[model samples]
Target chain A: MRPTVHHVAEEAGVSLATVDRVLNRRPGVRAKTVTRVNEAIAKLGYVRDISAANLAKQRVYNLVFIIPEGPNSFMLGLESELGQAKLYSALERINLDILKVRAFDSDALANVLDGLDLTQISGVALVATESHRVQGALARLRQANIPVVTLVSDVSAAHRDHYVGIDNVAAGRTAASLMGRFVGHKPGKIALLAGSMLVRDHVERRIGFEQVISAEFPELDCLTVQEGRDDAMVTRSVLADFLGREPGIVGLYSIGAGNRGVIDVLTSKPEYGSIAVVAHELTEHSKRALREGVFDAVINQDAGHEVRSAIRLLKASIDETQVIAKQEIIRIEIYIRDNLP
Target chain B: MRPTVHHVAEEAGVSLATVDRVLNRRPGVRAKTVTRVNEAIAKLGYVRDISAANLAKQRVYNLVFIIPEGPNSFMLGLESELGQAKLYSALERINLDILKVRAFDSDALANVLDGLDLTQISGVALVATESHRVQGALARLRQANIPVVTLVSDVSAAHRDHYVGIDNVAAGRTAASLMGRFVGHKPGKIALLAGSMLVRDHVERRIGFEQVISAEFPELDCLTVQEGRDDAMVTRSVLADFLGREPGIVGLYSIGAGNRGVIDVLTSKPEYGSIAVVAHELTEHSKRALREGVFDAVINQDAGHEVRSAIRLLKASIDETQVIAKQEIIRIEIYIRDNLP
Candidate 1:
């Protein structure tokens, strides 16, 4: 005779939901209760007909990824990975919906978040802009029983279930360390480039970079950061002007997506070959730059990793399952010319 | 009326097995066939209750992890992660069995592989010793339709389905670059330490370290590798002897375990502060060393990541499913004191 879930529940002296949660690997059930349920099943010699059970329930996770619409290679890569994830919907049982909002526009992001029908979307994964409006929207989603996970740049104010990205502060420290090591105690001015101070990631990176550089390489002077809004032309123009003003700058740390601009400026002045340059994101431009010796190192977080991690986290949240923390950590990868891949 | 598997098969002009293959996300079906089947299902408005279907099948994967028994923190970490994975088997439908062979013993590993009951075990993940005997055993497993995935140290000669570890060459190159950059242009000899050259990972790392050091930092002379067999006491004795013999050695690249031994040698001689040290695996000893400024850098591959990856890869192989390549590529992580975990 086939032992049913009811039998196991009765033997375990637990509710049906508890048994189901244990069976489904969902969180919320106590470890002792889970053990009891398993022991009861073992005693009954119960074998789960997983296919029939899943077919009976017809579980499908309706997940949405809110990405900032941009020409940035990193964002594009994220979108591409999401598309790939969507293609595996049959296996994952995920209905992945992608929404693109205005990049860096908090109002636009908030509106999108507020507009989401929680009944329709079981989970939301977004590259959030940290703002009061965004926070309010995320709080609303949480209240409505919808899980929200922040990606790439995290939002502290939001009720986000998890953050699927690297530590920006650590990333910055790594950049500074690389710059210090590459420059080799040579007393020279170091230039810092960023998109803006509005984003938490950029701000944290700036703070971390400053902390490391000031402590370790006091001989080298790190100048004030120049915000180029991550625009290539703006970055190029600003960097060119800065380079002209500070010809003594022997190291450059571009901790943003405006690497093309940095590369353009560096390419125009080939005579500054000795300048040790480190940038963020391994985009096509940066990869090429690393190969050509325009950039000494690129501190990158794989966009694919971020997107997949967000999806996994959101799905786990939806399933009420515990995700392996170590598996979910997006690494701050350092790439040099020799080890590009 | 809902569509059934028969309807899908008829619509796609394929067999029931082909439809099942496509529906199960198995690898054997052609892409065009899968697309046709999927299109047919969509056209017929077919919705599969995947959980119920899987439940009906009652599929359970009996997998094994073959690890080396040692006090080495990295190996212990791997075992711990595997234990965690086993705890989640109720959800993954995996019956995980762990087999610990004698450390670094090719014959012991080969015997274990040869002894596996293919009828009971669906897949195997092993920290393989690269030997002809092991390869032959792996070939037998393949012949019996049992999938094998090599973890940590890989065996290229085996008929293993996949290797779930980072590129050792890239890791060694990264270590060398960090050591070279950290040491600057200071002219001094660098000592290389390893467990054994017999393992593919150590040999590859040695080659990569040598390649980068010779090409980029010709000023720093990297010495021949001293095999310590990964035993702490042996590593300590060998390193102590080497330090005594070459007092001018300014850099140490310990490409294997036995970091504790290295730390012991370094701790005794406080004047070796100028010596740039780079080692692999982030363990308690190494982490403490990094924090104390005794070690400059640690190249680590997450044990949890490796275990989970090996399981995923093996499971996919057992299911004959396609895996996302980018997700499967284990990263070569470079850890400084600033960015630990």
Candidate 2:
């Protein structure tokens, strides 16, 4: 049988109500008292009796995911996954509000965030930028003692509580390893494609890719990266021009979305499909290309996990508990034509 | 702002006590009164404020997951994912008990189910089989009005509340498409290896594979099915023998677990490394093989999602409500070298 609140109270040598206050995060409990209660909790291995604690606290965290207003397949997939996650548990208990804003416009994000009822809003989870207005808003939220979490685009330097996505560097390394091995002992040039170099994920991925490929597979020369801004037209034009210049293009590593654009150009010009191609995000277009042998592998971070993990982290920040990192560390999926899940 | 109990009572033309009784599923409410309350609920769009409702009821659902005891990497991963999920919202309010039993042992499973307390255990979720004893226990639970949800391997014969997992047949078809596309324009033979023919997923996958490959990629000859019984040694030996008999094996599809064994044999043989190897469940071995150019692609199901989904389904089943099938349906994840997320 699990230990009850009464047992914890007795062990802590505190009154039942005082223990309740500490456990429920009620006001007027000193830090010392809270610490003692927590010590008792740890000693007893008392997994928080959430149902009983919730009964007393009735904490319905009003959460908001400030999604970017872009047609980025990954972000769209994230939004859809979040909406679907609502059907998972007692989601009605959550007052979830999705605040969609421009993907790269920090001013727009700050403007919208400033207008929300911060007191009533328990936490905020968003893909953010490192701008003054954003930092100021975060500071304000911190002053108000509200929890803040970042999604795909992390703002951990802002002292955010947790990050709930894949390690972009590891993903990049994995990509390089595949890019090196899959070309089958061929000494040729590999081209890397990215949306933008500014975003931390893309930057980290490129670094990892370069580091691995250079150290292990030196025979393959990695060309300079081309920025497509995740746009199909830009990708198509840029890739077409690059292919024309470099005839020995043996492999392609895409660090971001613009897969549809790449696929269109790859299949249209007969040589691209036969060459080893890799990209990110398993969208409708990517899935099709993977099936039809245009793209070789898709390194993906389960958008659903990211959404759910961000929520959990936000809630944890509000609650101030240590979250296990390994469980939340998202994996990079490797896809070939034969074993696409 | 959402409607309150008072508003619901007013809308239903009932008293506060009656509304409480109906909402709480108390025994005293009349059938006609319940119907009226339900009508009012629908009319007001009174989504039960779940946090507050849980607070008022102080109900802690004791949910159980009866997983089969096998050394399958997939099952271990499922358990690990379960451990991770426990840190989130589910553990706070729900008491989860995982009872590991031997797979394909209907008698033991039925016996175990018989002794359980439905009153205390609000819901039950398991990988069930079609058996008289198991059915009898489920019938008893139904009589007692307990919710029983089926997980990955569901017993459709038993009227369980919900099923929480992926469409294996569709996954198989997707795998087939990938295989057909990746091994394009090459004169090659493929092999379908499975754990057991009796398992629903393996059977369905075989059907789906045959369905797609025959119609789309007629040039690729999918060879006969082989069962490993999910045993490592058996799989390694069987695959090794099969390779001796069949020479032009260009494609390999491992439909189920015991992948380490497959990798061991395949990686040891220099001839097998060049073959397009596709398999299910991403384990340490698979990750290594992909890196070293042994395995090509890995199809995965997020065990965590499936476990969490099962628990939610069980809880919802106890309430006798509709579940969003789209949300519950776990997706098929395709992994390759380039986009390995």
Candidate 3:
């Protein structure tokens, strides 16, 4: 007994073709006609059968996910999740394409973004590299009325419609708090490790970490940040040298990828095992590190959640629908040895 | 063009009626015919247009959410989420009915379960109270081929199709780990609070908490549990009396509700402010306590996530469809001052 398009058309005294145009937001319907149809729909309590409408129209959203190409386990996992989402692409009427650019290369990322054909692409999600060129590309997409969601790392906020990731500042603050508590009152020096200062997430994390350490943990002091560029070998060499030089280091905070290097350094050196370590992201390396007591805590943002949230946001924007705000807030997940999953 | 029902019928060498019967799992179709139809579907890669199929069949799922009625903030939050879900009922074709019974009253819960008209109900979800009477009712529902999902709390494993909540044991273990670390190496007693040992989640949490405390924290001892029945007034009186007598208590683990009372007692008595407190669920009271440094950490299973997961599980069960396992996992979230959200 639910009201349908036919009921709305009958109530509005409009032709079926005009009702279809109004319902689909298609051009050719006059503003007055659209208003009349909408009023009729409201009056009749007509709930559009979205499935049938899509079926008749054969509407398929073509979305692109752009990410850095590298051995970063987190990004790889995200790529896998996107692949899994493709399994439902037929059912959801979505066509997903992934574009990979060199890691941390703003020029490459910008070129890829600028080259995208707006006509072929309905939406875009990217792990943005912060730069004016990239921002300009995002703004162009926005100008073309294409929805854009920034995943993981974000550029200028104004260019993106939504950001599907955790608050990096809060994540860093949480890590600092956990590091402070785990190290206790006898903390001497805390070693800071990051991917790069150029990356906005890393910079934001460093800001928050320094803010907490200086304000709360007066006994502890952070050593100079070592930018490992998220390369495992480079990170391993850098950490080894840093720890060797820093004698009074009582704690370590790995604020980005390259946890493997941190774990390697901690596990190989028995003395450093007692140094309370906090890291970001949950990977095979981090999980093992947590279990073996090398890493005291891990701050994680679920990649699966980010990928799915981006898809949902893009779809909602395309459909002009409201998403559940509470559900979309990606939580900063904290994990220890006891609660791994 | 996407394959239609007519295409499926033609490929299966059957009538459209037979294909419909097979797809909907209705009676009158032979097992051989069902297999043929399924094989044809697979061969043609015919993804079912679930929304269209549901619309065509006018399939409105009638689901019942049976939860304990009380002043418990967590339960109230869950109820509110259910109410929010009602907004999408027409679009999703789900009729959700909430049935509330007295909190912790096994007889009342069992009677309500037994009284449900099975013919009219598509699925059931409940915050279970462990008891033989309730188990029998669940068994009867299973016998009648009804899908049941346990929310927040779970009963015996065999009775429910899915559990849309975090692992209570792991949650308890995580709490103990945090408590032990936060309390440090100082030798003191850790007071344990519970709603009741009759509830399965509470009992399991206690068991896990004890296991970790005994195995790891040799300096700390858990005092006898104090059941407050999750009532603010009763918890206030019990905690006041308990803290007065238990002078050496350095940490408090609240395994269940009544956190408002815990907050009131801790804030009122400045002496108890230094005590490392860990409690379950995130509410206004818990958020305030966390922000004020009255509670060190909060172990939360998001009520919104649990409700959405339960609904998804129920619908998937009704439709005989697969659910994304990762999306359904209710993570044991650890909240601190820095990561309040």
Candidate 4:
């Protein structure tokens, strides 16, 4: 039979309340007593029944996920995954609440962060819009001892406890490498499409993409980037206009959302196959495009993984438990038609 | 407060013992009483604390992992992951035992399975070697009500409860697609390497690789496969012989282990960069090879993910619980130099 707290208390020669205080790291416990309890626990090989302890305490972690509200398919998919996570939230003893703010609006994001009830919320995760005001709000949360995690887009400041997303710069470099290889020896201009440069992920992706294109693929020239606000309609018009105006366009790299727009324009063109396309995120539109030989590659970060990792990190912080670092890494997933899903 | 069994029993006008029987699906409970208990549970939104319940029952799952004993880096890595899992086993109420048999010895594997004490083992997981003898053993286990999970490699017979691995056929096709694109328009032979044709994963990969090469890349010809038995010495000698005799080798596809030999042979040749290389399973050797430009790409199924998934599947099978399908999918991860992690 496994040892229990009673065994630990008897071995430590302490009262049950004293053992409990040491186990929970509560105040008013002397260092000598805490050491005695810990030695007894280690010697007895007593693995704490965390679930039973939590049940006894009725500890419910109140976690909030703050994401951008937009027409972006990827963000919508993230929200959908959070909705799915809610089904299992009760079993995990987590009360998950989602807050939506205007996309890329630093003032709105900061306002939302500043207005949070610190006492009610155990942790916070947000798709950050990098700005001084937002950084100040994050600092305030840190001062209040609330753990903060950045999801999807991370901030430049070091206020967050953890970042549960892929390395966007590496993702961009990978896209560039694939693009360079796919459009081998073709001397033509490459068109770059992004959601907005205001976000750190987009800017980092652009930097990595441009670095590779210039360093290796000298035959290809990158055209000026056009911001489409991640909207399908706006991206479609921007891409259509770019294609009409630019000559010798041989490659297209969609750094962010608005792949639906890129696909629409490419499919309607007669010489679509000549232009190698690489995009980010896998949605129904991108998956179909990949099958139809429209998009050569898609870079993805699993939204389910990110959401689940965030929850685990928040819970671990609240519990003061160790987490497996490797299991939490959000990999940069590269998908082609042959290896979808 | 979260509802307890007493609350459920009170709401249902039944005894606590009756509620326990219904919750645990034990026999001797009337259908009407079960319905009443279930209704009360639903009305109270009672989510069972599985860890606490298991603690109350003092349930410790004894799980066995059977794998082939070899110098194969991937399998070694899998074993290492299992070793790491052992550290957390006590906390999880799991007792993990690893059993090793001779590599590619069907009778040895079958004997190991046949010799298991079915009464003590809660579940079994194995890296399967498909054969009639093994199939019979699996069938006997199934009849004895032992939950079994196939890990890394799957068996053709449907005796196993779940397969915790990636689709090998799709992985092969993905390799072929990448090989064809990397060797664009080059008319030459492509060398195929495998551990052995005795395993199902290697055979399926060969089929998918050939299918794509014949249908799409007409310029490239697939050479006869070399069976290295996943040994470094055997692979090095065989590949060196092939390189000496075969003319105009433009690409290489490694379907299984023994990548250390491939890297040694390729690195020795001055024209290594001329050949496009794609191999399976990322290890220290493959990772370094990729960084050194010796490997164009590495197709990987995370060993850690596979091991963890197998454990989860086995436990869920034992508990008769539903698994999150999306979370369990083992993806065919494509790694380039830029995105190593």
Please say which candidate is ahead in DockQ: 2 or 4: 4
Greater TM-score among 1 and 3 belongs to 3
Q: Per-residue alpha-carbon lDDT of model 2 for B93-163, expressed as tens digits?
A: 77788888887788888988988977688888888765878888888887888878877776764557776
DockQ (Cα-based) for each candidate: 0.46, 0.24, 0.70, 0.72
Docking quality (DockQ) of candidate 1: 0.46
Clashing pairs in 3: none
Error of 3 at B258 (Å): 1.0
Estimate every model's Cα lDDT from 0 to 1.
0.86, 0.79, 0.90, 0.90
TM-score of every prediction relative to native: 0.90, 0.80, 0.97, 0.97
Model 4 misplaced regions, further than 4 Å: B42-44
| Candidate 4 global lDDT | 0.90
What lDDT is reached at residue A4 by model 2? 80
For model 1, state the Cα shift of residue B6 in Å: 4.2
| Candidate 2 lDDT by residue in tens digits, A220-284 | 99999998888788888998888889888899999988887898889887767668887888788
Candidate 4 lDDT over A221-335, as tens digits, reads 9999998889999999999998989988989999989888889999887876788899999999999999988999999999998998999999989888888788899999989
User: Considering only chain A, what is the TM-score of each predicted structure?
Assistant: 0.89, 0.88, 0.97, 0.97
Q: Say which candidate scores most in DockQ.
A: 4
Native contacts conserved, per model: 0.58, 0.31, 0.62, 0.61
Model 3 lDDT tens row, A1-341: 77888888889999888998997778998899999999999898887777666766678899999999999778888999999887866578888999999999999999999899999999999999888898888889999999999999976779899999988999899999998899887859999999998899998998999899999998999989998999788899999999999899989899889888777888887898789999999999999988988889999999988888999999999988889988899999999999988
Residue-wise C-alpha lDDT for candidate 1, range B1-341, written one tens digit per residue: 34689999999999999998998778898888999999999999786644555566678889999999988788998999899988766565788999999988999999999888888989999998877898899999899998888898887734788888888998888889888888897889999999988878999999999999999899989888999888799999999998889878889999999889999999897777778999999999999999999999898887887888888888778766677888787778777787777
